[model samples]
Target: MCVVPTVIGVMSGFFSLLPDLLPMILPSEVQITKASDLEAQRGGKDAPMIRQGAVIGKSDRMCATVLIAKPRCSSAVHHHGEQETIIYAASGKGMRHELSPGDFAFIPPWTEHQEINDTDENVVWILIRSGPEPVVVYLTGWGGDEAKADSID
Candidate 1:
């Protein structure tokens, strides 16, 4: 039945049906990402050059992404415009303020902060934002020039 599978977060793929059945049957609001279908990206060897770009997208209400933090590096002080971000530590624990595995943190809309990883390994964080797309406004520092806010990622 759907009870146990739903409770444990198992996406039930239909056994036999028309080729277009899934798209027609499943509600568009529900996004089921299978484990094997998920993609993960990590920082490359020999320290990656600082980069910024928006890849995460939204179906309608929220946008989600998997961010891998480089070792011994921190994100630029930035804000998410009107979007709120929820972060979950997936790997390489001990982020700033000491978030361990399975830990979660919330960032309000337009709140400026950085994700600092002091460890030697890449840190992975699952980010879910309360908006239809990712919006990143980079700044020179906290309360610094908003004009330098480039890349709405």
Candidate 2:
């Protein structure tokens, strides 16, 4: 079994037993951008056009991220071992195996899935995934950096 160290903190100056006690903070700002902006920056790169901030990595057992995607943008079908995920749509609408905002879906370990934005505007969401060094394997679709890809596979 893989042993993942954990850290616990107290309100009044805490001590961390693990090698690292990473703090997860809610972003204070949200910036909206168009698909055109992403296209200009990527130059046709097959990457998720992130219009806002996204949680790419975290040191904790669970990592939370926020992402904004323009219409028609989709995530690749992927799966991982010992990892589960929950996605909450904050705004806009989309389809994820018959799921949308105000709707919650639990992706089990090794389950193949992807996300798509069908609206003309942007779709915003909060995603949370848990596991020790959780690995996400992309089966199909597009958009991910080298580090992100390496972590998943």
TM-score of each: 0.64, 0.52
Candidate 1 per-residue C-alpha lDDT over 18-123 given as tens digits, one digit per residue, 9 for 90 to 100: 4558768774675565544343232343443223223345354687776777788777777899998888888886445788889999989988888888889878
How far is 38's C-alpha from truth in model 1 (Å)?
5.8
Q: Which pairs clash in the backbone of model 1? A: 136-153
* lDDT of candidates 1 onward, in order: 0.69, 0.59
For candidate 1, the per-residue lDDT at 43 reads: 33
Off by over 4 Å in 2: 1-48, 51-59, 132-134, 141-153
- Model 2 — TM-score against the truth? 0.52
Judge candidate 1 against the unseen true structure and give its global Cα lDDT, from 0 to 1: 0.69
Please estimate how well model 2 matches the true structure, expressed as its whole-model Cα lDDT: 0.59
Sum up the clashes in candidate 2.
3
In candidate 1, stretches whose alpha carbon ends up further than 4 angstroms from where it belongs are 1-26, 29-55, 147-153
Tell me the tens digit of each residue's lDDT in model 2 across 1-153. 433332223422344422335323333354444555434544433445453224334335776555566777776666665788887877788756555667776788767767778768777777677853446577644333223555432
